[model samples]
Target: MKLVLDHIGVRVGRSMHLDDISLTLEPGSFNLLLGPTLAGKTSLLRLMAGLDHPTSGKIRIDGRDVTSLGVRGRSVAMVYQQFVNYPSFTVYENIASPLRLGRRLSAAEIDRKVLAVAEMMHIDKLLDRLPGELSGGQQQRTAIARALVKEADLLLLDEPLVNLDYKLREEMRAEMREIFARHTTTVVYATTEPQEALLLGGQAAVLDAGRLIQFGATLDVYHRPASVRVGEIFSDPPMNLLAVAIERRGSGVVRLSPDLSFPLPSHMRALPPGPCRLGVRASHVALAPSSPADIAIPATVELAEISGSETFIHGRHNDLAIVAHTAGVHSYRIGETVALHLDPQRLFAFDADGRLIAAPERQPGTVSGAA
Candidate 1:
């Protein structure tokens, strides 16, 4: 179903939970609602599911107004972060319960549907086990199976994998993607993790403090953020921001700081001269030899953290603290001096109002420094 939120706003007492949010979700597309805690992701999902009402604006499905419909009135299903299940019922019974409600089917048909969804969730073997007898992940899978069996027009998942173990979470993420791809249901998934949004590879709507910050294709938003806040929120280690003055010099040179400067690309020659914030992803910072297009800075390593496949090196160049995300395990001691290379093409510049001014196009064969 095509879902539309027209300037929707939710108010609880004197506090506003959602502030004039407007967006249209296409049918059969998986839309990710991404933000940190208290960013109103859950509240927005609840509103879409008809569990809550908007104080202003309208909610439409397929161009028809459904603002007054309750949860039971809409063809929608929801799964929360918490594992919700009927403790007394077995997994098969739980998944079959929704199918039996307000509908009549032959015994064979019900059994066939139940077993199909059970197998898809990888809980077919645990069909006879009660919720109390199953592990947390198993119980959650049963809940998801129940929701999927309904074949609802819209599916709302609010961090359903948040409580699972790291390995299980990774496994479920891939499985969920495949399941959703095969179905025609419009899905609205909520999560606080930026990596989850990227992995899902769908349209992303970034929410911040009850407001919709930016909405677009996932990779487009990541590559070219609309604002500094969007860049910081979408990044894993977060985008490194440096306050600098833009000096338009002869021969297309721009000075960012006393120790850091680079030749501006031809496209950025028309940039107005003034104070601007330089934004660089940690993955773009390197310790390798400087290429002609790279800006090198001498800095002392303050801390180094090695995490299996990658190492995070925190260094200081003059008064600026720089973070270099390098591949594989690397040894570095505190106070050790090293030259950090910054690729000119990978840099982002933001105006004084924190709005993105320029984001250079990513070139082919460009290596990501951050894991």
Candidate 2:
């Protein structure tokens, strides 16, 4: 199904949950809605699923207006962050429930569909078990299986793996590509993690504070964010931002401090003079200088967060706080003096209005400083 949301806005009394949101989801295409909590990811999904009517604008499914349609009238299946499954019904019956609702598929056909979907979700062995008897991951798989068994026209997943354990989440993440590849449903998955958006490698629409911020191919949005806000929201640990002044000297010069100044890259040549915001992804900020041309700044380490095989070093360069994301475990003590190296070519130049004027050239797949 082709899902088209035209200027969709959801207003509840005085509060705005969605503002001028417009997107067209092509048939059989996989897409992602990424943002932080309360960013209107769920609200947008509800609008897409016809669970809630928009206060303004229209929603069209396959070129036909469906803005006034209710959830019962559309061919849609949604899985929430919470594991929702029938506690009393056995897994098989739960998976078969949707098919039975139509009262069209025979018992034999229902059994075949249920068993097939259960196997696909790796929950075939637990078909006889109740939701109460299964592990959290198993229960979620059952819920997902029930949704998938129906093969609805649109499948909406709102952080479906978020409640699972780390290992289970990782396991499911690996299977997401293969699992979705088997179905023709227009999949719309929501996530707060920038890494998950990249890992999924689909079209991504970024939302912020009830507004649609940016939308495009996943890598394009990651590599060339439309604005400073998009960069911060789309990057893990957020993009490091610093206010700087740029003078229209030879090749243009940006002065970070009295002692730090460098010629801006050609991409930033069109930047308006005077004050500008410099954006550097945490991944591109190196811990040490690779060459003399690399700009080095002295900073005091504030904290070091080690997550499995990765380490995030948080430090402050003067009043500007920065986070450096890198692979492997690295230790740093509070108050330790360290040098951060930044490549001018890899810098992002934003206009005073926070709009992106220039961005580092796209490189090979690298995000959160991980390969």
Candidate 3:
């Protein structure tokens, strides 16, 4: 089954919850809606699941307009961030409740379905355990079993791993991916975690302030963001953006900064003349023994952090504080003078309007610079 949303919007007084949201999900594809807190991720999910109606526009499933459909009318199962199992019921009874309450199966059928789901979720061992008896992770597994037992055409998960501890969350994420691999149901996962979005999504939509910032394949969103905000949202330390003026040289070389300048690749040379931002990831910011004559800026190391696998050096230059992460142990004494070398080809150029002007063309070993 296919799910399509077209120009759907929801407004609440002075606040617009969703603005012209549009997306089409293929059958069995795992899709993610990701954004920062209060970005309306949950609101969009609820609207898609028919639990809430948009103020305007439509939602269609298999070409049938379901904008006015109620939650019960839509063939979807939602697993929420909160583990809402029945406190008084055992794990077996909780997993079987959906089957029993729906009345589509006999007692024998319900038992078989419940057992199968429990086994798939690795919760069969806790069949006799109540919600209180099981740990947080087990309770979440039971809730998931219940969701899967219903056999809906679409699976809706709203931050389903948010309630679990770090280790448990990782484990459950792996299990969830396995479950998706075995089923052909369309899955819409909502999360604020960029890593989780990449891990689970075949496609993803980046939402910000109810606006669809960008939507496409996971790698596409990361490698070629639609705007500066998008590039900032996908990296850990975030993409390092610096203001740069485009100065025309006889041969397409633009003066990027007071201490840095590089020839505009053939692609960016003919582009419109205007103000722009230069972006590079932490990994691309190179530190040399001294500033190069062509381009270099004096910076003072603010701090140096060693985190086992890599070292992070936070420093300041030209009134700009920058963070750089490199593999293995590196040493930079606090308050020491240093110079940074940024890869010209690795830079992303954005216009004054914050829209992407030119992005780094992918080459081997390029890290999608910062979220």
Candidate 4:
């Protein structure tokens, strides 16, 4: 099912839910709709599911117009954040309901399909149990199993495991990926978690406000965000941005501060000397210098947020606030002076309008220097 959204936009009353969004999901392609709250992730999913109509543009499945169609008119299955199931029906019955309603398969075939998906979801032992008899994670697995049993051409999962605990969510994500690889259905998954998108390892359509910000392979999009806005939204702690003045020497160079400066990346050699923005991921910033070329910026610790086995040190480098995501839980008192080391090679460059002009070399697409 080649899905195409031709400049789709959704307007309700005075608010616009989607704006001039155009995208294509190849048949059997797994894609992620990534954004924060009110970023139009759900709106786009609803429009794709045929639950909502676009105010403008068109939608096509396999080049056939389906813009005006409703959910009942398409071979689409959707699983929401909440675990939705028939309260009175057992897990097996719930998984078989779609087959029964469509009247497209015999009882024996439906039984086979239901059991297979149930096992795949690791809920085979709970088939006879009702939704109320299962744990939150089990109920979600049941809901997902039901969606998978339908064998719908398109599957929309709107944060299906969001309600589960941390351990359960991690477990479910690995299984979900394995399941998705076996099915040829075009999957459109929506989530607010940037880590989830990265784990999925597929193409990503990043949304902001009501507009389509960037769309491409997940890692490519992550390493080379089209703009500062995309970088900020795609990052977990958000990318740290520093305003700097670019000064071109006889060759290529940039002056970030009186004591900090480095040669311009190869890609930015032709950029005129003036005001520009530098973006570096939190993971790239360190509390200690890693190399001789590293720039040590003196900062006062503002906050030290410890999550799991890592600590995110929030510091103020003059007027700029930077977050350093480092391993192990480290303690730092407020107003403590620390030098944040930055690697010039990993810096992302952006222009005055907040658009990215040069991206550093990254994995898989690795180059000798910055390009």
Estimate, for each residue in 240-271, the C-alpha lDDT of model 3 and write its tens digit: 88876776766666664576666776546665
Pull out the clashing pairs in model 3.
232-371, 233-371, 234-371, 235-370, 235-371
Decoy 4 TM-score against native: 0.96
Q: What local distance difference test score does each model get? A: 0.88, 0.88, 0.82, 0.89
Over 1-371, each residue of candidate 1 has an lDDT whose tens digit, in order, gives 99999999999999999999999999999999988889999999999999999999899999999998899989998899999988899999999999889889888999999999999999999999999999888998999999999999999999999999988998998899899999999999999887788778789999999999999997788888899998888886788887777677775566656866777765566678777787888888888955777888788999999876789898888777888888889999999999888887778889989999899786665424322
- Assess every candidate by TM-score: 0.94, 0.96, 0.89, 0.96
Worst 10 residues of 4 by lDDT: 362-371
Worst 10 residues of 1 by lDDT: 362-371
**What is candidate 4's CA lDDT for residue 176?**
82
Distance from true position, residue 123, model 3, in Å? 1.8
For 99-198, candidate 4 gives per-residue lDDT tens digits of 8996678878998999898988889999999999999999999999888888899999998878999999998888888889999999999988778888
* Ten residues in sequence with the least summed lDDT for candidate 2: 362-371
lDDT per residue (tens digit) for residues 216-327 in model 2: 9988988888999889888878889988899888778888877777887767888878998999988788898767778887889999999989888888877778887777
Question: Which TM-score value belongs to model 3?
Answer: 0.89
- Regions of candidate 3 where Cα sits further than 4 Å from its true position: 265-270, 286-298, 303-311, 327-334, 364-371
Q: List runs of model 2 lying over 4 Å from the truth.
A: 364-371
